[model samples]
Target chain A: EPEVTQTPSHQVTQMGQEVILRCVPISNHLYFYWYRQILGQKVEFLVSFYNNEISEKSEIFDDQFSVERPDGSNFTLKIRSTKLEDSAMYFCATRGQGRETQYFGPGTRLLVL
Target chain B: GESVGLHLPTLSVQEGDNSIINCAYSNSASDYFIWYKQESGKGPQFIIDIRSNMDKRQGQRVTVLLNKTVKHLSLQIAATQPGDSAVYFCAENIGTGGSYIPTFGRGTSLIVHP
Candidate 1:
């Protein structure tokens, strides 16, 4: 029953500030992903990471976003400049080798004012 | 340009009743599908999944039915309890090549009354 864990369950930041959301995926997972959901919208994919590199990213994952597995265990998503529209719930998901199921973390709620 | 969508926005059921949720996908290339439950303040939790090669799969008290021809998916919960109330979402993934990123649908809120 190992699950993904994220830090800073809730965060409120001012516009134009940089924010980094952290996640620690299951130890044996090989693929990691980031998704965001606006208050009343569907979950949107941001980016996917594997082998220390970005595998694929959506149009919303523009210049301001970057992901890193800096320590091999800590997967992080950083936003260079937060906008008011950036307010949403950011989720981290991981998939182990040979598995098609992606396990999700509790999520980090980000609010920009 | 792929999208997944739920047939209904909300469904209410009595405790101990069975509940069925439906989803439709616009992508014909999607080969893997998953159903997730999201309670308030929590992320989506995996409930069950089915591959394009299979038509049905069951887990615990849950069953997933997939129709490749019609591009439809449904999740069935037996003996639904009050704790089963949550927002459920269906996600589609194009498992072709090495890409496994999933596209999630708008969730359907399930309310179970005791």
Candidate 2:
């Protein structure tokens, strides 16, 4: 089974520092998404990307957050000026074209100190 | 916390027993629904999904039942094992024209004991 893979399984950064969480979606998947879950909270959608641009984003996806398909296989999420509340388990997911079964990665645990 | 389902519901079962986790969705327009499992320090793993058009779908050791009339969904795991101890979530969304931005339900913790 082709699965989504994320780099830097765990990251710790100081507040106000910038951080990039990297992910490589399934080789043939077309739609990519980013979601975060604070400890003991439900997973929340951050943004969705398709066709090399953002398709939609939630209110939590503010100016401090940005996503990019920097290459043919790499999708990245950059958080600028992180805050303590930014700490969460970030997940990257992808689905095939016209398919609703989205596969998720193992996630990167981001801790903003 | 005046946000959402502040406390997730929890279920405790013994090994070799069947586990049924239930969820009630708040959406009437949701056309697609999915069940995902999340272990202690990882992303959610897709377990199964059922469309509003269908009432039941079965997978390996797992079966999902959807009751659109009452807006309810349940996951039945057969012969639950200790490794099945994890949190399970039911998510719903209006799946039309290839959009999968789902509104997830508050997760339910399943503690399978030996």
Candidate 3:
């Protein structure tokens, strides 16, 4: 089964630095999303992307966050300035057209210090 | 519906036994639901789903039951194994006519003992 793929399985960055998390969804899927889970927390939606534009975003997805489909296969989330609270595991997901199932990637662990 | 805190409730079961995880959703408008299993170091994996119109749907070794009347949902695992030990979450979606995103439950940690 084809699955979503993410880069930098784990990352450590300094506070105030910029970080970008990357993902590659299943080749044929059309809807892509970014979600985050703080340690010992429920997974929360960050933003949903379709047709190169953001479909919806959560309140957590504030001014510091941005997402892009720079290429046919890559979806990325960038945080302009990191805060201590920004540390969490970020996951990417994709849902194909006509399919209700959304496949998730293993996730990228972001640690800010 | 109110957002829940991250302090997850947990359940323990022995290997080969059945395990049931329950959730009570507050939204009646939610017409779609999903169950996801997440490991210690991984993301949520899709397990099964049930539309509000259906009472039950079965996947490999897993069954999702929906009680729309009470806004309750449950996931039943048959012959549970150590591999089943993980945090399970219930997510609800109104779909908003294809406009709304899914709202996820706080999650429940399930531990299967050998």
lDDT of 2 at A47: 91
Against the true two-chain complex, what DockQ does each candidate achieve?
A: 0.89, 0.76, 0.69
Write model 1 residue lDDT over A1-113, tens digit each, in one string.
89999988999999999999999999999999999999988999999998999999999999999999999899999999999999999999999987888999999999999
On residues B43-66, what C-alpha lDDT tens digit does candidate 2 reach at each position? Answer: 889999998899999999999998
lDDT of 3 by residue, B6-113 (tens): 233899999999999998887777788888899889889989998988999999999999887877899999999999999999988755436346678889999999
Q: Between the candidate structures 2 and 3, which one is better when assessed by TM-score? A: 3
- lDDT value, residue B43 of candidate 2: 82
Tell me the whole-model lDDT of each prediction, alpha carbons only: 0.94, 0.88, 0.88
Question: Cα lDDT of model 2 overall?
Answer: 0.88
Best by lDDT: 1
Tell me the spans in candidate 3 whose CA falls farther than 4 Å from its real position: B2-8, B97-100
TM-score of chain B of each: 0.96, 0.89, 0.91
lDDT of 1 at A106: 95
Scored against the native two-chain complex, candidate 1 gets a DockQ of 0.89
**Top-DockQ structure, candidate number:** 1
Off by over 4 Å in 2: B1-8, B95-97
Among incorrect, acceptable, medium and high, the docking class of model 1 is high
- lDDT score at residue A46, model 1, on the 0-100 scale: 94
* Candidate rank order under DockQ: 1, 2, 3
